[model samples]
Target: MRSLPLTPSRPVTAASDGRPALPPQHLADLDLGQRQTLLAGLGQPAYRAKQISTHYFGRLTRDPQAMTDLPAAVRAGVAERLLPTLLTPVREDACDSGATRKALWRLHDGALVESVLMGYPDRVTVCVSSQAGCGMACPFCATGQAGLTRNLSTAEIIDQVVHLAGVAAAGGVTGSPPRLSHVVFMGMGEPLANYGRVIAAVRRLCAPPPEGLGLSQRHVTVSTVGLVPAMRRLAGEDLSVTLALSLHAPDDDLRDELVPVNQRWKVAEVLDAAWEYADRTGRRVSIEYAMIRDVNDQPWRADLLGRLLAGRMAHVNLIPLNPTPGSRWDASPKPIEREFVRRLRTAGVAVTVRDTRGREIDGACGQLVAAETAS
Candidate 1:
C-alpha cells in the first residue's frame, strides 16, 4: 500500500464562511412517529399527519398548495416544519434527451455541492453528494483537488433526494413520473467522512413513507475510498445498504496513488473489512474501479483485481475515468476497457462497465462542484 504524505496544517476552518456550522435538521430528518407527534402538537388531527406525508413522501410534493386535501392554514405550518427548504438550485444542466440532469446546489451556508438525476428506461437513479467537497485527497478527483469545505448535515444530504425525487416525479421528458429506483453516493463527497449523517440519512431514505421517503434500503449504495475503521463501524450499524468500495487499483502501491487513503488502510485491510460486511449483511459489495488510461488500467492489474474479488460475494463496476477539464487523467481506451472486463470475466468474477451518464454536463464525479467553486 502507498502512504499518503501527511499535511502539517489545516488551511480551511469553520469560520471561513463566517457562520457557525449549523446542524442539519429537516422534517424527513425526524423519525416518522416523531414527525407525526410534531404535527399533532400543532393542533392538527392525528390522521392529518398521514395526509401531509402522502403529499411529501408518496407524492413527492413539496408545494403546500399542491396538497389540496389539507386545510390552507395547516399548509404553511406543515411546509415550515416538514418541508423546510434545504438546497436552493444554483444551476441545472441537462443532457441525454433530458433524461440526465446535473444540479449544482447552494446549501444554507453557501457551500456548493451537486447531484445527478439520470433516467433510464428501467430505472431512474439519483447520484447524491454526502459532503460539500472531500477530505480524502485522492489527487485526481476534482472535489479532492479543491479539498473539503465541510461535512453535509443529514438533512442537507436528504434534501438532494427530496428535490430530485420531485424532479423525477414531474417527468420532464419521461411521460410518466420517473420511478426513482436507485441511489448512489458517488457525487461530490466521501460519505464515510460524514459518517454519522450519512448513516442517519440512509435510514430516513429506507423508512416507510410519512416516517421517511420509503425507498428500499437495497436500492441505496454508499461508496467510500477504503476507510477501514469506518467500514467496520458501518458493518455493525445493521444497515443493509450496499457498500461500494472505490478500489481504484488492486494493490497498495497503485491504490495509494489513486486513492491516497490507501496509505492509511492498505488494500488487504480494506478488502477484509468489505468481506466482513458482506458476510454479515448478505449484500454484495461493489468494487468501483475507475480505469485511467495507462495509469491503473493495465491488463495485469485487471487480472489481479479479478483474483482478489473472485470468490467473495462482490461485483466489480468498472468506470471509464470521466476525465474532468484540465485534469491529467483520461479514460482507458475502448479496447483496453473491453479487455479489462474480459479478464475479470475469465476469472469467473462478475463485472460490468458503468454506463457513462451525464457526460455532456461535466459528469465526471466532482466536476460540477469544481465548476461551482470556479464560478
Candidate 2:
C-alpha cells in the first residue's frame, strides 16, 4: 500500500489545523433551534439558519460563494463562525477500481482519523471514525495498538460523511452514486467509548435533510467490542441502528486474549446485551468475527461460537483478518475459514464473509493512519 495526497495542505500549526482551530461547534454539530440561536446572536434573522442548513446538507456545498441564498455580507461570517471546518484532508487512496476509497484526515488537534467509502451495485457505504484513534487495545488491531489520541467531536464525525457525500455527488465512485445511502461506525475508535458524541452524531446523521443527512436509521450500523452498559444504553435511544458486536472469539479464555475488553465484560455478558438490544429495537444484531490463522480459528472455538450464537436474532459476519504489518495475526486459510462457516451454519446461524476491500490501499481500519504515523 502506498500513500497518495488528495489535496495540497494549506498551512498548519504543529497542532495540525496549521492554524488556530476554532472550538468545535459547526452547524452540523448543533440541534434544530441551536443554529437559530447562533445566527440570532450574530444579529441575523432566525430564517438564516434554515438557509445555512439547506446549503450544507441539501446542496452539500461548503463554499460561501455557492451559498447564493445568503447575503454576501453574512456569508463569510456565517461560514467562519457557524460552519467552521473540522477536518482537513491529508490524503486519500482509491482501490477496487475507484469503488473502495480510503481518506486520511487531520483533525484540528492534529489527531488523524480515517474513513472508507465503498460503492456497491445497490448501495454506497462510508465507514466513519467516531474517534481519532482507538483506546481498545486489541492486539491484532492497528488502531488499537496505537492507543487513543482523542475522541472526535460530533462535527468531526459528521464531517467525514458530508465530505464523502460531496465526493459521491461529484461522481467520485465507480458505480456513480450521487448520495450516501448507508453508513457504518467501524473505523478507528471504539464507538461506545465516546458514547455521548457518537450518539449525538448518530442523531445528526439520521435527522431529516436541512437538519441532518436524512438517511434511514436502519441503514446505519454502530460497531463495538461489547461495551455491555453502553450497548444496553444504546437500545434505549430508539435510533434503530444495527448494533454490530465485534466478538472475535466465543470463549472467555480466547476472547480475553483477542478482545481485551472481554476480560472485563466476558463473552456471555456481551452476547446477552446484544440479544437484549435486538429484542428492544427489533433489529438483528451483527456479530463480527475476524478469523485469524491458528489463533481463534480452531474448530473447537468455531463450535463454541456457533453454540453461543445458535438461534439468536443475529448474523455472523466472518472477517478474514487483514494482516497488519509486524503483527502475528493473519487471516485463516480458505479450508479452515469454510469449516468455521460450516460450523455456524450447522448450528442454525446465518453467516457471510465480509468483502475484503481496499487491501492495496490500506483499507483495513486504522491501517492507513498507522502507516502515516510510522512515517
Candidate 3:
C-alpha cells in the first residue's frame, strides 16, 4: 500500500567512479591513433592496424593463428600487445532448441557479464551488456538487483557483438549463416550512465572495416533509464542508432520508485529528451515499459501512458515482467495484458509485447545474479 522504498544509484561514466578500464593495450579499447601508436611502438607498421582490424573486426576471429595473412612472425606480437584475450566463457546455456543461446563471460578480473544471442527467421540479434553489472536500481530488473560492478571497456562490449557476429557468420547454431543484424544495449547496464565508452563503442561498431566492425548504425540501439545530459549528448553524436528509454511507469511518483534515476530526471524531462533524440537521429525512439502485476499495470496507468506517448515518433515495447526468482513482482495476467494493450491502441499508440526470451535460462540481463548465486 505504501510506496516502495527508493534505493540509491548513480550514473557511471567510463570509469568515472575511478573504476579501472580494460588493460591499456586492448586494441578494441584503443582509438585509431592509439592503435597505430601501439603498433609503432611494437616496431610494426601503422598499416598493420588495418590487417589486424580486418582479422579481428571484419572476420571476428580473435585467434592470431587463424590470420595467415599476417606475417607469422609478427602475428603473436600484434595480438599480444593490442588484443589480449578479454573474455573467457564460463557457461553457455541454450533454449528454444538452440535458437537462443546465453553466454556468461568471465572478465580478466573475474567480473562476469552476460550476453544473449537470439536467431529469428531473417536475422540474428545480440543483447550486450555495457557494464559488468548495473548501477540503476530499478526494483523489477534483475540487473538492477546485482548493483554496479564496473563499466565495460569498449573492447569488452564489442567482444560480445563480435563473438555473436562470428556465430551468425559461421552458422554455429542454426546450420545456415545469417548476418547479425540487430544489437540492443538492453542487457545488463545503464548504457547512458556509462556514456563515453558506450558512444565510443557505438562508433567502433559502426565505423568502416579496418576501423570498426562496420555494422550499420541503424541496426544498433542504446538504452538508458533517462540520464538526461548523456541523452542530449547522444543526440549530437550524428549516429543514427535508436535510443530506448526505459520508462517503466507513466507518473514521476511511481517512476521515481521504479526507475530510481527518475528521481533526478522525472518523466516529462525524460520524454522531452527522448523526443530530441528522435528529432536528431530521424529514428523513432523506443519506449520500454515492463508490466508488473497490480503494481504499475492498472488500466488508468495505461491510459496515462497512452496520453504520454500518443503521437510521439516512438514505439512502445511492453515487456511482461520476467519475474526474478523469489521476487514479489510478476507479469500482468493475460487478460489484463490484453486490456492494457487495447487501451494503448484505443489511444492510437503503437505498441507490441516483447517476446519473453531467455527467462528460463536466467539470461535476462543480470537475471543471472540469482542463478550464479545458486551455483
Candidate 4:
C-alpha cells in the first residue's frame, strides 16, 4: 500500500522559490519604550526616539525620512535597528472590485498568517490573525487543518493593522489619516487560544493616538471557537471589544464533527459561557454559523439555534461556507439559506448573512495559506 501524501508542513512565509526563512522579532515582546531606549543607548535622545515612534505608530509612516525631526547621522541607525522588518508580503490577491484584498504574509520566523482589507461603503474593516496557525482543528477551516504553530506576539498582530493603515494613510483613502474604522480577529487562527498576547494586542490596538493605534474598543471584534475557560477569562478584562463565537452547530453531536473542540466543551457549556460573557460585559454576543450545503444547515438546526439564543442579547452572522479546493463541504443552496434566515427571524432572532467577500480569491478563513501549503 502507498502512503498518503503528507499535507505541506512548512510555514507559508518561505521565499517563493523555497529559500531559507527569515526570523521576525516582535516589538511587543520588548519592554515599553524599549525600542526607544535601545536607540537612546546608541546616542539618540529619548524624545527623538518618541518622534520616530510617533511616525511609525501614530502617523503610520514607514519611511525613515518621514521622521524629519531626527538628526541625519542618527536617523539611519534608528531605522536600521528599531525598524527591523517584520513581515514581507509573499503574495497579494484581490477580488470583489478591489474592495477585498487578501495578503499571504511571511513573517521573519517563516511563520505564515493572513489578513484581509475590505472596503465597504460606510467603513473599512480589516480581518487580522491572532496566531500563526490554528490548533482548534475545526474540520472546515484550512488553518485548523494545519494545526497550531504559535501565538503571534502583540506587535506581530498589530504590525498587520499598522501596515495596512500605513498604506491607506499614504494613499489617503477616507478619514483624515485614513484610519482603520473596524478590526476583526476572525482571519487565521483561534484567538482565545492565544489569550494573553491577544489581550495585549487589543490594548495596543485600542490605545489612543501616539501611545497606540487609536482605534475604538467598540470597533474591534475578537472571535473564538468557544474556548470556555478563555471566554470566561476574557469577560473579566474590562475591555469593550465584541466577542464572537464560532458556534457552527447548536447541538453537541453535530458540533463535535464541525468543531472538534465541542468534544471538550459541549454546547451547553459553551452557551452558558457565552451568556456569562454577555451578562458581564453588557455587549451582545455574536454567534457565527457557517452554512454548509447539507451539513449543519437544516431548518431544525436553525430553529434550535434561535431557541438557544432567543432571550439573550445576541446577534447571528450566517456565513455561506466558502468551499476549499477538493473539500467535501460546500456552501448551502440559496433557498435553504434564505429559509434558515427566515426561520431565525420568525423566532425573533437578529441575524444577517456575511457578505462573503473575496470568494473569488480563496476568501474563506484560511484557503490562501492552505493553498500555499499544498503547493
**Candidate 1 deviates by what RMSD?**
6.8
> Higher-TM-score candidate among 1 and 2?
2
> Which model scores highest in TM-score?
2
- What local lDDT does model 1 show for residue 314? 95
Q: What ranges in model 3 sit over 4 Å off?
A: 1-24, 175-177
- Taking the tens digit of each residue's C-alpha lDDT, what string does model 3 give over 1-375? 111232222222235566654443477887777888888988889888877888888888888878898898887887688777777776677777667888777777667788988888777888999998889988888889888988888888998899888977887556334778788998889998788888889999888877888888999989999999999999998899999999989998899899999989999999999999898888999999998999889999999999999988989999988888788999999899999999999999999999877766875677665576567
lDDT of each: 0.83, 0.88, 0.84, 0.81
Which model, 1 or 3, shows the larger TM-score?
A: 3
- In candidate 2, stretches whose alpha carbon ends up further than 4 angstroms from where it belongs are 1-23
The lDDT ranking, best first, is 2, 3, 1, 4
TM-score of 3: 0.91
On residues 1-375, what C-alpha lDDT tens digit does candidate 4 reach at each position? Answer: 111232333344565677644344444344448766776678766776567667777888766766777777766776566665666777677667666777778776667789988877677788999888898988888888888877777777888888877656554333323557899999888899889888988897787755677889989999989999999999999988899999999989999999998999999999999999899989999999999999999999999999998988899999988888888989999999999999999999999999978888888878878887778
Query: What are the candidates' C-alpha RMSDs?
Result: 6.8, 2.5, 6.7, 6.1
Model 4 bad stretches (over 4 Å): 1-36, 172-177
**TM-score ranking from best candidate downward:** 2, 3, 1, 4
For candidate 1, give the lDDT of residue 142.
87
